[model samples]
Every structure is written in structure tokens, then in C-alpha cells.
Target: MMHRTQRQIRTDEPSVAAEALSVTHVTHGLTVEDSGEGFAFEERVRGTALLSLESTRCTGTLSGAVEPGRAMMIVWVKSGSAVVDDNPVKVGRPVLYRQDPQRFRWVDVQHDVLRIDRTIVEQVAAERGDWAPGPLEFRPRHVPEGAPLAAWWLMVRSVAQEVLQGPADVPVERERELARFAAGGLLTAIPHWPVGQHEPVMASTARFARAETFLLDHATEQITVNDVAEAAGLSVRGVQAAFQRHHGITPTMYLRRIRLLLAREQLEAGDDRSVAEIARATGFAHLGRFAGSYRQEFGELPRQTALAARE
Candidate 1:
């Protein structure tokens, strides 16, 4: 999740939103023009793999292009009608595209639209294990109704639901699971070749044991995820998945926890260093957040812990 989140976009005029949408963010390089029927736009997003709602009352064309195979573009019309990528888009059905949609244009003929772009697939895939495959391709077709489709649809909606109404702060394992669903689900649903052919490597718990050894050995030193990854002989993402899966917490957080414990040892031993000095030595650059987390973990402030030992 983001430390700071921007939920809604403000547009007093339809053309103003057109200008805002012109610039590319996590979505796509989209261009919207007012067809004189008026347009209403509001988008709320949290984390990657965004879900957007675009409602159009007038006639307009939405033209843009996204990179091929890196992501999937899906649009569902709950009401109204639209023409997407030169096909008369089916109402309440998902339309999939694999290639960069430069020529892909959508004409909203009195339509309301919901778009889901799995644009962060590459990022998520990097965190999981790697696979070697040829060029991936997704042929455009309708997903037929069935039990399998229903389950997948529910999974997709659940992710969106989690973002909209779920708790702001969740565990690392929870974050990993949500990201897996967003990226993993799209990778399976879309038609891809080599990239999707090989299974993701979920290494055994032994990798976590090795990583834990390294973190404990260097818990007092300033360390990074990359440093931990190098010590474990695994990619950064691989270590992340392993730690979260095995421990339900991230490697970095675990390191921080141990560092705090080590700092407390120093304080209890009547070290000459001040509390701030101890904090700096413990690899906590932000004194405030460190105190907050420390209080939550130990049920007392760092200074209080230090003073208690002295008493």
C-alpha cells in the first residue's frame, strides 16, 4: 500500500479530465475528447493493478496504446454501449487485448465503462519466481460463461473490493497474496506463450532459514533488501516471497525487529550512548516512526525501556 494515496480526480469540465487523462500513469496513454454529450469521470485507486470507472453520456472516442503482453486491458459496460478496438463491445463482458493498442480506439455511443488494467504484471512477476518463455500473445475473444469463469471473476472483484473497503494496514503476506491474485489471475486468464508456460518457483523453507541466518548475523548493521538478497543467493523478489510465505513478515521488517531488540540489549546493559544515539545505531533513521513501532512492539517507549533498566 502507498504511504500517501490520491483517490479522486476533480474536473469541473469534461474537457479538463481529457487533459488529465492524456498523461500516462499506471493506466495507459489514453486520449478522451468531448463529443458534446458531456462526460463524468471519477477514479479511485490503491496500489498497483488499478480498477477505474469511466462514465460517458455523450459520443466520444478513447484512443490509446499499452505495451503488448506486459499487461491485459479489460473493459466492462454495466450500462450504455461502446465500440472498443473496432469491435462492437459486448455489454457486461470482458474484452482482452495483447498487443500495444496504439490503433485501438473506443467510441462511446451513450455508454458507462469500467476498466481493469493489469499493467503491473511485470512488477509482480519479478517478485515471484522467473520463467523462460517465447513471445507471449493474447488473442481477443469472449470468455464463455461457466463455473471456472465465475470463480475467476469473483477473485478479480474480490481484489477490487479489498482495495476499496479493506483495512489500510495489512500484513506482508496479505499484500503478497493480493498482488499474486492481481498478476497471477491475469497471467492465467489471458493467452500467453513462453511467459506463462513455465511454473513459478516456490522454493522450500530452507531458503528462508538461510536468509534468517544472514539477517541475524548482520542485524546490528545497516542492511537493505538487496544486501539480504545477495546473502541468500536469491533475487530480491524471490527472497521477498520466501520470507513472506514462511514468516508472514518481510525480511526488512524482521531485520528491523531484531535490530530493535539488539538496541534494547545495549540500553539494558547501561551503555553510555543516548537514546537517539542508540536509535541511530539500530538502523532507524526516522526516530519518530521507530519510537511508534517500538512502542507497539514492546508496549513502552524506547526511553521508558532504557530508564526502566536503569531503575
Candidate 2:
């Protein structure tokens, strides 16, 4: 239920903010308190971002140990000033909660504020950019400026409306595209090294086919990025860029999928090996995560696959 595609919840209770927003800080044990004068909170969540519009009788404080994976939390203070962690969050200025999620502590939300909390990552954008993939961090700035900021906000709003407002059960490919666009926009908007996005490379079916052949051949081995790169006669980044461009998937993801298929094939063949042994033999080192992934992809775990084969 945590990965609900879209949700719109409105509550007048200030007590529900913490539970309503399953953000890292709050869920990781941040204590939040709003002065109980009059409060209205609305949360709109799409696949990759959580947008909140909160108006409280008084300001609320988010205090506790910071949880990680806050790739980006762009906070725009619609009205009164907020105090984020130890710093003052000025009105009309966008406060970025994390360039580093681990270093961030807390947020004190002022009354009568409409805020935006964008969950961001640039890595998923695939081969659209030349920038080295890593955590998309921003410099400490009160108001995030320029055309990209406005453009990104606008795009997110448009995508949210389309995805969240659309009929039930948005398709999986559309969801994946949404994630790629959001992350791609962030990468375009933010100031980062290896500057500027290269135009998206057209997918090369031949290249992907070649890579696929190599991967299928060595699917049972513990291959690293370097190995793939070397076999492909390209640099690591080049391999990633190529796979991402052509297949809309990274080499690692492609390898994992192939391995999962191999594992399933083995299971369905009713091989004498146990599930754990088969998983290990197929280069799925973490048995639990492998089973989880198998269930997700094949709609049955490895054990179930074996059972179905026997039956």
C-alpha cells in the first residue's frame, strides 16, 4: 500500500501530519507538533513525488535524526517563514531540504504555507545526459532560481495531473516514463558538474542485441560493470549509456532480468538443485531479494516456480 499510485487526502487534524507524510524524517522518528489553533493539510502523491499544501493555526517543528534517500526535497514557503533544521526558511523562497540527506536534521513549518516536497534522482534518466550518475545535490540556496526551476515545477505538475488524475491503474511503462522524466528534469535543472545534458541517444537494437547475447552467455557468472564494459569493448559509462539509450534499462538491470529468467528456467526445469543453490548458481547472491524480485517479475517465487514445475 505504501507504493499507492496516487492519493489525495485532506485532513483538518494537525495530529495527522506525521502519519500522513511518510517522509524519511517523520517516519524515522521525527517528532512534529503544530499549535492546535486551526489546521488544514492536503497531501497529493504521484509515483515519485509528494506534494503537500499545509496551513496550520501555528508553525510545526520536524525534529529528529534525518533519514537518508531524500535525493531532493524542494520546499517553497508560500507564506510565513519556516525554520528548517537550524536555519531560517524565508517566505517566498524555495528551501531545499537535502543536498545531503544524512546531514539534514529537521524542519519547522510555519502556518499558512503551501509547500512542495519533490523526491528526485537523476540516475534513472538513462542516456539522456552525459553527467556522471550520482546523487543529485544542490548548493545551499534560499530561492532556487532560473528557467529550469520553473520548468521542472511546471512539468511535475503536468505529469502529476496526468498520472494522478487519470483513470485507475496507470500502466507500468507510463509510470516508468514518469520517473524518467522527473529525474531527467531535475538533472537538467540543477547545477552540476559534467555540465549540460546530451540529447537522448536513439536506441540501437543491434547494440542491445549484441549486449544481450553477451549477457545471456555469461548470465550465470558474477559479472561486474567492468566485466560488461570490457566485453562490450566500451568504458563502464559507455556501456551504461548504450544500454540505457537502446533498451531503456541499465546493463545491470538487463543482467539481473536475464539472470532472473535463467533462474526461473532452471526452476521450471525441475533441476535437482534447491532454490537457494539455484539462486546462488545463477549469480543471485542475496536469496531473499532474488526471491522477492522473482515473485515481482514472474508473479511467483522460486519455490512456487519449482512447485508449479513438479505439478
State the C-alpha lDDT per candidate: 0.54, 0.53
Return the top candidate by TM-score: 1
How does model 2 fare in lDDT?
A: 0.53
Candidate 1 residue spans exceeding 4 A from truth:
1-4, 10-12, 24-31, 49-61, 64-71, 107-135, 169-173, 195-311
Clashing pairs in 1: 133-194
lDDT of 1 at 200: 18
Per-residue lDDT of model 2, residues 205-264, tens digit only: 233333444555576788787887776567788888876764467878867776776677
TM-score of model 1 (CA atoms): 0.47
Q: Model 1, residue 57: displacement in angstroms?
A: 8.2
How close to the true structure is residue 192 of candidate 2, measured as C-alpha lDDT?
38
For each candidate, give its TM-score against the true structure: 0.47, 0.45
Candidate 2, residue 52: lDDT: 25
